[model samples]
Target: MTISTEMLWLIIGCAIVTWLPRILPFIFVRALTLPDVVLRWLGYIPVCILSALVFESLLDTSGPIVSFHWSKVLTFVPTLAVALLTKSLSLTVITGVVVMALVRFML
Candidate 1:
């Protein structure tokens, strides 16, 4: 469907509002002194968010299963172990997604 001019303007305005908060940090990061604790937490936020998302997607469902899905457990348990051992978020997520997809396709 074609968007109306008013709707287009609203979307543009919303985009600007959404972007300013994210942009403001980079714009001001150079001019400020940051607390070490706050900076460390900020560094961790993305990994925490990613793990939360992966956990929910892997483990949360509307109904119960007879036994835990072994393949999902197989995929994610190793993913977490590797992530912790190596301290690599990207590798962990990629392995989890790939292994789960492979197991799903195989069975």
Candidate 2:
């Protein structure tokens, strides 16, 4: 229940380590002007990251071979529909979570 002095120091050290990487980018880029192409390319980062995460999560790889989860696939249906129709991240995430929870509870 009580944190020792050493543990406190460890926590402070971890905080500084985590904070530096996040803050350094802003400090270094504040005055810099990136090119238009670079800026345009950076716009796709979110979509690419999301696609990678979604595909990885949908296909499970706990064993030697990659396997697809029907629960996730089924949940993705309504989630994708909502995302495409509304184009809202919040709604899509909520729909996915609700569908997955229902699928898990029912099956």
Q: Who wins the TM-score comparison?
A: 2
TM-score of each: 0.49, 0.72
Residue pairs of candidate 2 with colliding backbone atoms: none
Tens-place lDDT per residue, model 1, 12-84, is 9999999999899999989999999999999999989988886666664656854445677778787888889
Off by over 4 Å in 2: 4-14
Instruction: Evaluate residue 89 in candidate 1 and report its C-alpha lDDT on the 0 to 100 scale.
Output: 76
* Candidate 2 C-alpha lDDT tens digits along 1-107: 99999999999999999999989978977789988998899999999998999899899888798999879999999999999999998999899899899999999
Clashes of each: 0, 0
The local distance difference test score of each candidate is: 0.83, 0.93
Report how far off residue 45 is in candidate 1 (Å): 1.4
